[model samples]
Target: MPLTGLLFAGLAHADIAPTESDWGGTGLLQTPSAQMAQEGELGIEVTHVSPYTRYNFTLQPLPWLEGIFRYTDIDNRAYGPAVLSGDQTYKDKSIDIKVRVWRESHYLPDVAIGIRDVGGTGLFSSEYVVGSKRFGPIEASLGMAWGYMGSRGDIDNPLSIFSSRFNTRPLCGDAVGGQFCSDDYFRGPAALFGGFSYQTPWDPLTLKIEYEGNNYQHEPLGEKLKQDTPVNVGAVFRLNRNVDFSVGFERGNTAMLGITLHTNIAQATPPPKLLDPPPPPRPTTPPQQPPEQVNWADVSRELQNNAGLKVSKIARSGSELIVTGEQTKYLYIAQGIGRAARVLDNHVGPGIDWYTVESTNESLPVVDTSINRHIFDDLLDHQIDLDDFQRSVEQDAPQPRQEEVLYQATPKAFDGGLSLTYAQSMGGPNAFILYQIAANYDAEYHFAPDLWWSGTVSANLVNNYDKFTYTAPSDLPRVRTDIRQYLTSSDITMPNFQLTTAHQLADGLYGMAYAGMLESMFGGVGGETLYRPFGERWALGADINWVKQRGFDQGFTFRDYHIVTGQATLYVDTGVQDVTVAVSAGRYLAGDWGGTIDISREFRNGVRMGAYATLTNVDGRQYGEGSFDKGIYISIPFDLMLPESTVERAGFLWEPLVRDGGARLQKRYSLYTLTDDLDSDNFDDNLQKITY
Candidate 1:
């Protein structure tokens, strides 16, 4: 059985019903309620409401907070027909945040405050506080909304009692809309909105009715939309646990339809189907007294074939046998240990009283796990249970004392493979979809334990880059916006080629140095150092780089652009919901001084999703389209999709718009990531899944 199967051995499997929600929101039609998705849940929604269509991606990064990214298209507005060919619509990108103030109780309702379109063109911006309560099979919600939601002026601004400035909202400032217009926030007239949802006897059906606050008078693109009535009705049909379908009659005139696909990233670990068989059972009884000579070669082969370990060296210190090796297969470190223990029992004699397994990654030591030979022997013999065996094991830093060297396996030098690669860009004025599919050849040559040379060559097989014509407007150096030129200029390209060396300088201190073609756009030299204590919640690091832009063909040729850039970074593992915050500040590729803040949540299955925003000295208008650089990315471990265990991962990043403002060097490696095994708590968590 796989490690995940062993961890969740007896859990029952059954159909899980989908939760009720609006188009892309967790509430009734047209208005938000206090409901929230389960923690670690990710949802993608596509909603169409006549003149406007919204694409939403939502994440419950924390129990008390929900983050949303949306791209809305105005069906009635065109993106300058004279400047572009074919039919194109004007699209706006926005971000939203909602925070739960209080949870629901028997007598109290769940309360939440939310801001919509915080830093976008003030087209659909709104702020509101809402509450929801459940009674029997029905749930009720109510709220007061301001800004676009209250544009009908249904009632006088009650907040004006405190200040006359709250009576009217100021006109939106600039066309480039990255600035947060706090002056207009919650200042205009307010209106009341409420809704109710009913769970029907049919398990998959949910009905909703809402009285919306917005009258649809102030629509995007200076078009006045008519609202026949304030009441809206909708229904959600649960197609399955991961999908939902919804349709509604909104504004008593327009028909709305949407679909949502959701999944719990933390619990999506599938059992491994392709794995090595369990280790051979322990000897039925103690072997004679001791073995005069053991076949160490056969023992090493067994450990490698069955335990997923590549032994570097094996030696004896006092009465304990130490095996130093790297794990290449098992996802859980303990599983590897469990299997290695059995291999030791069969090969070594009773003279070896203890077994010390030192695990490493790329030849760098990670942990030293010591096991009681007798305890493990008893468990394998069915005389004791696994829980008791686990209680007898100890783990700490490796203390390797040279005594008698038994064996040292040959190290692998060169490894390479070919794989399919896809690159895409969307939601820009030039083209709705621009993509390239290619065959990528990746190879790595290991020089020593912690040093290697790696590179990737991509050959385009299919693409539509000819349609990419829009030259993004930017006042600063074109560090990234000239992506179209790069894509169209090369049918065969080299994206990365670098020589990297990583080492442990001292306890809890790690360092990395690299040079060559760092990325497709730039090539240079850089180094990074990080100080992260074992089992600690925080870490600090810094990096500096001097790079020059590579030619459009992604070849050895260099461009005129060159700059020195770097950042001092801080990382904190916030105890809430496996969240991590990374902040970096320094100089950017465009010679601008700025900082970036990134917050991400790691699921139990190694799925990481996060958002980041970069701010620089460049003005919003000068930076062009997005005002600033911002994007959301998800890193998925290949093991989640493959039947076999792997250390590979794939990353997908979505940026609303690409610009030149806050471009950072795309370094291939970082010290913080290289030293991840220093986290002892993570090792312990994976150890708990061990089963022999």
Candidate 2:
């Protein structure tokens, strides 16, 4: 999936100022530069230059890395025959990346290396190494390139000096397209490109000029144009910190216009929660009053209202008050526990020395969090700080609390959400994009904490998927390619219907089972289990499901196709660069034996971007277009966009070509997500928020 392009990041470490280029990266009008946006910086850009209209979504997931996904519409070219392509213009999809090699300094310029077209049709394939130096308000960049970027043949092959293999540049972009084209990298006549941008006296305007690398003779799909000049000029107007508009003239013939919407995700935060109840302020000094009379019923109400916990019971174990409940609102377990501690402090006896929260989900034990009352009080009284308090906090596996019962809670048996979802498939033979919009109704009934029934009913609002007429030929089972049929099946569809049960099998061990309609296309039974030591960086999980294909109409019916599928997965959270990796191997939906590796970066603010690829036993040709299953995905916290805080996220996954060979089930739930407290990051991150 890294080859596909991820779409999230935070800040940049480059000293060179970033400018959105025609090709989507940080650069001048027609060529890239050594500049890089901040990590977690994300941008959506649209550029038009003569015969090309390009839409680019670029991301800086790390300070030193940038990735782009671009779609280009070429003029005067049809995708194919009118009947098959519906008069659609030629559309090209490509991925690109840039990485910071060195940060600029007073004595030296910033440097970078990059690829223009990675694993798509090699229409704009090129590689370069560039450097940018700043002088007062002027910034200049110079770079050498190969492939399309070096079409001018301004110089002989520089890399050929090292090996004769680099003397010849091979033609790329296979008939099927989407090839890696690695052998063509930096092998050919090279070109020199340089540019300079000047910040004008006018605050909002900047001017730039760059030398052309390509002569316009070697073009995509054999299209050709005459180069009137080697120099291009552009001017950019910044409307605000997040928006920019630019216009330019390149090749002395073509006019260029573009707009970019950019923002940093890691630094972004939700607006103030003016609508919710505010937490009680910490006291400037510890209370010296006598033990106060307490009402257990009122304590339960306070915990539910202020802590977002659906309390099961509250008990006392000597000097400790233990509360067993499920967090129903807060995104982090520490948030819920911290809030509960505040309510307990006011309601319990003054002698209580410890506050413990035994968190649960669907009645299954999660983890235990205990905070020393003296340390908490000391912090509240300004006698200690967060650092001193953390030493007294303990998080571990659920523990037995044979204590005195005080308060009990009634069950709020059902909860769900109503959401609108927009689904899309892009770059099809018949159409550039096919999209569907639907309204979903989710419902769940709790039989008890350990068992429940949950399902989703989605009603189609509208769709433009009628043009989904082409299906790539696959030698394996058609487990996933039939998405078109499923999408068009009915006005109302029940994609999921299941009864599930889960319980804690042991310390660091959990188990779950479910049966019924498991997903839109499959139904039957499945089970999963996970072993995650509290506070550890690694976890092991496995899931197995036996399912039958569903009918196209999505009715209460099934097709004859059936198979057993499963996977054994290991997840590791590498503290370096806030990255996490997941490795899974087992049976795939198409009866293929394969494995998948997923890599992602997560920020403390709840924004995550990742890519994954799966390889199966089948040969590349047998697996159909694009070879195998691979995609990029991003998950953003809904709190960032909503008026009020919510423990929900918006997610999007981009799959270039969805095939069957390495397909995996889109599970309704996972232990990794259900019990996210298996790791200590959240606890450490949210510790200071307790008093707030």
Clashes of each: 0, 9
- Top model number, TM-score: 2
lDDT tens readout by residue for model 1, 1-692 = 12222222322224342353443557787788888877766678888888888888887767788878788888888866646735788878788888999999999999999888887666788888999998978999999999877677787888899999999988764787756778888888899999899989998889999998888878777888888999999898977567678899988889999987776665666455466475567677755434337777788888888888789988887778888998777666777888888887877776888988887766667667898888776775678876787788887765547668788777789989999977788777766678888999999999997889999999999988788888887799999989888888989999999999887777767788899999999999999988887668899999999999999999999999999999999999987777899999999999999999999988766778898999999888889866888888877776666666666777778887878889988887777775565555454666644553
lDDT of each: 0.80, 0.82
The superposed Cα distance between candidate 2 and the true structure at residue 687, in angstroms, equals 3.3
Give the alpha carbon lDDT tens digit for every residue of 373-402 in model 2: 878877877898889988889877887757
Q: Model 1 — TM-score against the truth?
A: 0.93
The regions of model 2 sitting more than 4 angstroms off are 1-17, 281-294
> Which candidate wins on lDDT?
2
**Model 1 misplaced regions, further than 4 Å:** 1-23, 82-85, 272-292, 376-393
